[model samples]
Target: MEIFKSDKIFDFMGKRLPFLALSALLFLGSLGIIFTKGLNFGIDFAGGTLVQVKYEQNAPIDDIRQILQAHPKFANASITEFGTPQEIVIRISGSSTELGNDIGDTVHTLLDPTGAFEVRRVDMVGPKVGDELREKGIMAMSLSLLVILAYVSFRFEWRFAVASILALIHDVTIAIGALALFQVDVNLDILAAILTIMGYSLNDTIIVFDRIREGINTSKESKLLLVINESVSRTLSRTTLTSLTTFFVVVTLFVFGGEIIHGFAFTMVVGIIVGTYSSIFVASSFLAQLKFSVNNYRAREAEKLKKQKEKEKMRAMYEKGTV
Candidate 1:
């Protein structure tokens, strides 16, 4: 089950160039998506009305969409299956063209009574609120990154700090890109999910980083690279077990958490797997190129000891003179 055995430590050395080139390409692609396609902001950001409707019998989601789209006000309506075929969720843009209470009333008049239908929930978001929310989301994400960078750098070495944060940025960019390409909704819940993903991704990176630090600090016998390789190998079981457990939880949520939170669950699932990969290929790999000098570490320790001795000698001489 172990991929990185004693003999396999040098396996990646041959493919370093290829890996670097591919990583550069992926980074560039992510940057391009960020600047060009951008994020498809959800109702929470762009402001919109979300209407959840339930029916007694299974109904066509398309029929409900068609019904709403017929209205000029609800022309931009998008409908999706909520819980069951009988349940449908609708989204209408929140702008000057918003249908507001009129759309809800129309659904009640047009679709209710004739069949067993009821409005389960309705939420309206204003454009001003959406603008503020968009700004807040950006600020929160930026703050989280800054905090992670500082914490990781303080806790570990600068190389680890750089690699861990880079992996995080990589995961976030890839997640956002997937969202943009697939047109996933970027709502408040989804924003929460993205932030949660960042945290989750950082947790995975930190686990490996922690192991790397332990390997370096304790192992005078093994080479640095060998120590790291072993550290990753030893932690494989725990990593796999944790990831599988999380995967199942997310899958359950995606399957049964209802449509309202489905996007959030989906985002978590994607982030977890991406986080796992980045910890291995992305973060661990970077440690090999890290600027670590045993001489520097030894010199610092010697200097600290010398300073302590000098202070003690000075204190002893001062005490003797006083006596």
Candidate 2:
């Protein structure tokens, strides 16, 4: 089905300055939020205990919170309903293995003195391990971007690669910034989501870059800006269709995937939207601003034509002499 049938001719490059300015403000604002407010690190990144408890019936969340607050050891714990009203997950900050063992007993005694509640699971991550994971997560994200830069530069031209990387950075920064702004809990799953976003954003950018390269090589458009605009217009339908389908799937996951995958789904939703925008506006606009080194391509083509003419002249002279 065609969502957009007519070919669009949007002057994306013509309005690059304004779009870029908006992106800059967003980027800076996100950075500010991250630095000031910081992310709400989950148990995976911050040392903590996660205890999952299932009650025989629907338990009052406020009663559970009040009970935990009554105890000195569990006073600062974060308690939330996991999957259903009958199940709740309790998170406490610490690396102590003893706490993991004792927490279940303590919560069970406080909530259900007769043992009506069952401790389904108790997980703990040490502070040292959390620190390591945090470092590795950062490294993984950095390495992925570096590898993408190398791959794109080799596959296309350096300018396309640079623009694509910048666009990816923009997508990631905005995604993380949104998470921080909204106080979403950051964990390994969210880190994985950010990496996934990078890959998705890169794929979208590469598609646009591929189309632009094809236009530059074949189209007789005198201006690079016009070539870019035409390329984007040609791929507009495809981009829209792909983004829409992906968005529907992610939104579905966000709504129904439960707390376990909530962060992942949220990241995907943000990434998809930002990625689509960057592919069309940010990446393509950079190409237009740079003029995509059209002069070099034109000069190369002219040299090739000159060489062909010289060869033809020599061939003609040789034929005449033979005659």
Candidate 3:
């Protein structure tokens, strides 16, 4: 369905300079935020031990944090109420076997010498394993980009492949910057969200690229800028509808998904917004900047003309021979 009924022509590519500048500013700002503030890696990457405690009364989250702060081992522990105010979840720093498998006893003894509170459960991850997971996550992101690069290059043109990649990276960098800026826990779920965002952004970009390719193939417009602008304008409705619907769902998830998938939902929310923006502004504008050549189209037309001439020549020969 089309949102816009008018055959209005938008000079989207004409005002690309300001948009490109804005994109650059945002991209560099995101990089700076990432390097300076850094990601708040969770147990999946940073490695840590978690303990769930059930206090006899209110969890006393502030008191527990104050106590843990004074202790050398848990000086930087994470303390929060899980379910009811009486149910507390404490995360101990360090991924050693002792912290992982035995921190429960230490926490129980230190928090409640009288043994009033109960140590509900304890979970752990080794430092080595955490390092491996981090490496693999990086690999997964890199591999996905490489695959997209190769696929787009083979499917369309190198310019489009590069443009789409730029848009994808732009979307990811901004999304990750949001995570670091807000100090969101970068866990396995967040990584999954990043990958999902990459795919989502790529799909949107491909739609624009596909329209541009169609415009070029059909010689719908003489100027590359017109082709790009028309193509983007044509697909604008589809992009808006898809983005709005997906955004509504992710916003709902962010509100109600709970802490278990909170970061994931937040990532998706950022992805949808930034992904749509890059698809229209970044990907297509970059093509406009490159002055995408029509030499390939000229060559194809030449080939078609050559075949037509050959067919005509053969027909003339047959008519002369009266065969």
Which has the higher TM-score value, candidate number 1 or candidate number 2? 2
**Regions more than 4 Å wrong, model 3:** 53-58, 69-73, 81-88, 100-102, 105-121, 301-323
Worst-scoring 10-residue span by lDDT in model 2: 1-10
Model 1 ranges with Cα > 4 A deviation: 1-38, 60-66, 96-103, 221-223, 301-323
Question: Candidate 3 lDDT, tens digit per residue, 1-323?
Answer: 88964366688989899999999998999999999999999887888887889878787777778777888888879898774677888876665575535688788777874336899887687888889999999999999999999999999878888888888889999999999999988989999999999999999999989888887777557788888888888888999999999999999999887666788999999989999999988888887777777666567767988999999999999999965
At residue 73, give the lDDT of candidate 3.
Answer: 83
**Backbone clashes in model 3, listed as residue pairs:** none
For all candidates, the clash counts are: 0, 0, 0
Whose lDDT is higher: candidate 1's or candidate 2's?
2
lDDT, candidate 2, 1-323, per-residue tens: 66555476778788888989988998899999999999999888898888898888886788888888888878789988887888889888876565646777777778885336899998788888999999999999899989999999888878888888889889999999999998988999899899989989999899988888788778788788888888888888889999999999999999998877988999999999999999988998876666577768767767988999999999998999953
Off by over 4 Å in 2: 100-102, 298-323
Q: In order, what is each prediction's RMSD in angstroms? A: 3.8, 4.5, 4.1
TM agreement with the true structure for every prediction: 0.82, 0.88, 0.86
